[model samples]
Target chain A: MQVATFLAYLVAAVLFITGIRRLRKPGTARSGNTIAAFGMVIALVATFLVVEVDAAWVWLLIGVGILLGGVLGAASAQMVPMTAMPQMVAAFNGVGGGCIALVALSEFYQGAAETWVAVISGLLTVVIGSVSFAGSIVAFTKLQELAFTGSVVFPLQQVLNALIFVGILLLSANVLADGAIVEAVGAPFLSPLVSLYILFAASLVLGVLFVIPIGGADMPIVISLLNAFTGLAAAASGFVLGNYALLIGGTLVGASGTILTRLMSGALGRPLGKIIFAGITATATQKGDQQEDREVHDASPGEVGEYLSEEANKIVIVPGYGLAVAQAQGPMHDLMETLESRGKEVLFGIHPVAGRMPGHMNVLLTEAGVPYDKLYDLEDINPEFDDTDAAIIVGANDVVNPAANDPEQDTPISGMPILEVEKAKRVIFVKRSLSPGFAGVDNPLFYDTEKTMMLFSDAKQGLQEVVEAVKSA
Target chain B: MEQLLVQLAIFIIAAFLGFELISRVPNLLHTPLMSATNAIHGIVLVGAIIVFATADDTFTIVVGFIAIVLGAMNVIGGFWVTNRMLGMFRPPVKRVRKRKG
Candidate 1:
């Protein structure tokens, strides 16, 4: 039975790897998700078979837990709109982190830390798991705009976090020292178990501190980083229990999540270290206030639509988080169709970090029944803007901000790769105000009257009006 | 010690295999890939069960039970949402299957 159980775990790990392998392509990604879920089922059944439950009440508890969790999980997964997928992922990831932390705490309760390996790994799990849990909850709230959507910072913020880290290390060291000398002394000043509880609490606080300073616009990288932390915590718990399935599955997520974090930060044109440490504080640079008073060309949606319908032959649409906030994807799709019917070439230029997460805009656009090929990636569409007649930007600012290219200006988004929309013959911005983006950097493109126009309105309403004007024209 | 050595070996190899598996996912599938891997790590459910079954005291039992519930939610919700997100990415042709043969 032991051998059979281990074999089942190995088979489940193989299936998980195969599923991720299949996830590399769009055609097979859905089946890949199904395959991974199947692996989870196998591992789950094998776990139930091997665990020796002597009490009938424990069985009832287990059954009820699974049933309740399944119903809630399935309900939310089905009901959550695609626009809210980032927060949904964060919520689920938080639960997983919390679950792992509890597992570590329970292991300590069972006195499984007799050996040195067990003591270290168990403590590691408690720290990382608790941090991941608390951090993920904070991330979810930020993305959901529940309490505080902007970055929170004060003087000596990083110093306070550093002091807390040192304190946790000192406490953990005492725990390890207590474990080492307990058999000899018979009683120690501080019980290792008590130290662990303190460590867990401190780690949770550290997690909140770690995420609260990161701005909401940087939530994608933060989410990916927290996801990786949870994976590592799970692997550490696997070490505590000597479980093969947990080790393999956790390591897979840990590695992939780390790589994904790097990729996301790279796409946003920021180094991973800078993003984690400095964060985008949105300090409201001096350029923002002065730009408001500058002369600008603001056009009505009808005039802009007439330009697209009559003057422009090839057009590109750039989308941002504002599009998601205004729920404008549907209306935007109507505008796309209208432009296409006019014998104009219309393609979507999707910056990798355009929305709240990587590929976020792509998912929203695809959900609105836009053809897959109609969307082009950043690298694929950057050069095409030069020959394009007009670029229609909907609620996107920083991603297309010309400041990223100006070597003279030292803005928060300086040196970040932008869409180069100013290269197009004409640029029209549909936005609520001349305000800067989440990064708090003013856009020179909005002020270029010779080729740029602003249609001031909500994203959905502006798109609707533009569609009507284009149709009538 | 030998068992620990074996587990460590498995961990390193799995880490390498993971990096290789998702090294080059296209931007189109990044969200689904993150969601899928998120579900895979929900394998912590197995660990939760192991702890719960062996727990003797009330504190341990309560902690273990909550862990089980959270793990189950993570597993179910992660995979279900990934599937839904991936379902939105259809090919260029619209409703091709609706035509009669």
Candidate 2:
């Protein structure tokens, strides 16, 4: 029976690895997901059969628990729209953290061996799991609009978090040292169970503090970081329980989530340390030395169509959060098709940090049935923008801002990489107003008089007008 | 000590494996991959199940039940949502061309 359980976990791990590899491309992502889910089913069935249970009530409770949970998860997954995916993912991840935290609690209470291994594992699991659970809730709330999406500040937020961090460490050490090493710590001033509860509460508060100060723009990284935390916690619980499946699965999650977090932080051109510790909110102070207002050239949709229609020239489309907000993907696709039909080469220039979350624009474009080949990532498309005849901007503000290129003014997004649309021969901008984007910084490209033109309209309306104007011209 | 060391070896290898596997995925699929990994980590439900099946007293039963429920939610919700998100990424169905049928 022990051999069978270990073999099953090994098989499951192989499946998970293959599944991840298959998810690398658009063609195999769905199949990869199926493979991973199949592995999960195998792991689940194996767990149920091997885990010794004497009580029938426990079985009943498990059935009811699983049935209830499965229904809720399925309903929400089916119903949540594409735009709300980030928060939905966050909420589910939060539940996973909460689940492991409770498992750790049960292990601690059971007091199997009370060995140093068990004690340390339980303490680590409880702390990390609680932190992830609470932090994920904050992420979900912010992304889902249950709370404000901007950074929340108080006096010495970082200092407060640090103090709590120290307290959690002290409590954790007490759990380890007093329980095993020291015979009696001053006549047992604090009970182990009560001290654990206190530690749990403290970690929960720490999780909230950890996420609350970070804003919506950094949510993808935050979510990835929390997912990694939950994974590490789950792995720690595995140590307490001595379960191979938990150990392997949890470690896989921890490592992948961390890599993705690092990738996303690099895409944002911000250090991971600054994002987490400094809490670089959208409200960061901007130096006044670089403020300049130039004459704005507002163009018409008719003019945009006419420009796009100009004889067989290449054009690049840059989509951002505004495109998602305006629901302009379908129209954007229509425009792409229209330009393609006219023998003009149209390529999509996708910035890594274009939308609210990682791959936010790609998902929208894919949903709209945009071909995978036409999409070019930042590195590939940035150079091509210089050779293109026209660059069309729809609703995105900061991702396409040339201000990122300017060295003079130290704006919040100063060092971040941006879509070099300003390099295109003619720039057609579409927007409702001259409002700053999520970064809360004005785009220098807009105020430029050289070749940039703004349509000054809603995204969907602007795109539709351009399509109409193109058809007529 | 030996047992813990074995578990540590298993953990280190798994982490390295995860890092290697996740790096292969493209930026375009990051969100879907994120959701999918979210589902994969739902393996914690297995841990919850262990807690539930072996629960002895009232405290164990109560905490174990909560673990099962939350774990089940993560497993079910994470996989369901991931599949749903991935569903949006599929290619449009193409009509087969008739060969003089």
* Winning candidate number (TM-score): 1
**Model 1 chain A, poorest ten-residue lDDT window?**
A279-288
**TM-score, one value per model:** 0.95, 0.94
Summed over model 1, clashes come to 0
How far is A462's C-alpha from truth in model 1 (Å)? 1.3
Best by DockQ: 1
**Alpha-carbon lDDT of model 2:** 0.83
Runs off by more than 4 Å, candidate 2? A178-188, A279-284, A287-293, B91-101
Per-candidate interface DockQ score: 0.80, 0.69
Best by lDDT: 1
Clashes per candidate, residues 3 or more apart or on different chains: 0, 0
Residues A137-193, model 1: lDDT tens digits: 998999888965787877777778888898788777777887454344455566778
Task: For candidate 1, report its TM-score.
Answer: 0.95
